[model samples]
Target: MKLLQIDSSITAPNSVSRVITAAVVERLRQTHPGLQVIERDIIGAALDHITPVNFPSSHPISALAGDAPEFAAGRATSDAILDEFLAADIVVIGAPMYNFGVPSQLKAWIDRVIVPGKTFSYGPEGVKGLIPGKRVIIAISRGNLYGSDQPTAALEHVETYLRSVFSFVGITNLQFIVAEGVQLGPDARQAALDKALQETSVLKAA
Candidate 1:
């Protein structure tokens, strides 16, 4: 089984999402022996925002002969990112809420994967997702509470956005392990982390 582990946290060792994701991956590895794992740290290798030069419409027909060096490089990077996502049977994402949304680095990665003809398509039936049957697990951390009953629930965008995007690409087997209110206090942080870690321990294996 192929597993793609994507980390988008800028906090590294101090990141709650990162710690939860690591525990989840380790659990999966234990359950699925010899699983092939590919790790990508978006914060470590930041991707540029999509531009006209690297956008799919601007891809050159042959060898990118007429394309600028930077443009060609950008296109290649985008293609590589998309290819990795396509090749994975399972994907585990470490996403922390940033200003009530996902980090720009993760969004940049999403831009490459959610291609029109590659991952999805539009038809008379409306829209159709090309990629299906892949399992996705997201580890999410939030500084404040945003549960359905919370006053800030409407401001919760990370999980909502991720669900929409993944479902759009035909991935319905989605799981989320969330740690919220980590910044509330030391006690609250540890409690949240403990709960999230417990969830990771019971994750279904590939």
Candidate 2:
């Protein structure tokens, strides 16, 4: 079994999403004793943001063009990033809400991995997802309670945006362990984190 554990939080020790993701990865590792885990900290590594100027070949992978060292390096990095996502039997992402959305580092990584030809293909029928049935577990932390029933739910873009993006790529078996109201107070933070951790503990490892 292969597992991809990713943490995108700028704060390593002080991140609630990281705590939840750690618990989830530990639970999975306990269940799958032979699991091969690949860990990535986007913020820690400082992944280069994608730009039009440096974007790798848009053509098929077999037709990789350009001899420029920069383009070669960019294509290699993109391939590695996409390969990590494609090879994972299970994916766990620690997503902390930043200004009602995911952090820029996480978004940059997405820009590379979720490319048109890499993760999905377009046809006359419509956009068809290339990868499906991947078990994805998201650990999310937010300052306020913005659940579906909450008053501020309408303004929420973090989880909603993720759902849309992943669904577009045919990832349907998605589960989220959310620790909301984290900034409310000491008591609330503890309570929310404990609840989210409990959910992670009960997740099915298979």
Candidate 3:
């Protein structure tokens, strides 16, 4: 089995979510020794958004003319990114919430991987996910305690967006370990991290 560890945290060694995610990966490695792990840090090489400059091919159906060379240049990068994502048997995402949402790096990676006709198909019956039978785990860290029910719980757009988009690509078996209240204090941070670690333990057992 192959495991893709995608780290979207801007913080290198100090990232709380990254540390927890590494622990999760290590625990899984203890059980699945044969698992090959692939690591991708979006902070190092940010994904280019699909736009008029990057997604010229997508404009082929449009009446207006588009830049052929510019579109052709981005094809290789797009294809490589898609291939890496599709080849992974399991995907582990380390997402540290920025301003109550996902970091820009993570969103950029998502934009590249969840391409039409590659990750999903559009038919008369609507949309069908092409990449199915994959399990995904998202390690999320937040400053404040923002959950389904919390007084200061801000909008959980990061986790929700990930779930929705990955589900659209047929990844229904998604799990999340959120370490909230990290910025509250040292005690609160440790407590939240402990909870997240415990959840990771459960996930590993499964």
RMSD of each: 2.5, 2.2, 2.7
Q: Which runs in model 1 stand beyond 4 Å of their true positions? A: 56-66
The C-alpha TM-scores of every prediction are 0.94, 0.93, 0.88
**If the candidates were sorted by their TM-score against the true structure, best first, what order would they fall in?**
1, 2, 3
lDDT tens per residue, model 3, 123-181 = 99999998888889899999887887887555767888888999999888888889988
Residue-level lDDT tens digits of model 1 in 1-206: 99999999999889999999899889999999998999999999998887766654323332344567666777888888888898999899999999999999999899888887888988999989988889999999999999999999999999999999999999989999999999999999999999999999988775
Error of 2 at 72 (Å): 2.3
Tens digit of per-residue lDDT, candidate 2, span 107-175: 988877677876788999999888896888999999999999999998788899999888888898899
Candidate 2: residue pairs that collide: none
What ranges in model 3 sit over 4 Å off? 52-73
- Which runs in model 2 stand beyond 4 Å of their true positions? 53-67
Q: What shift in Å separates residue 186 of candidate 3 from its native position after superposition?
A: 0.8
Output the number of the TM-score-best candidate.
1
How many collisions per candidate?
0, 0, 1
Provide the lDDT at 113 for model 2. Answer: 68
Clashing pairs in 1: none
The candidate with the higher lDDT, 2 or 3, is 2
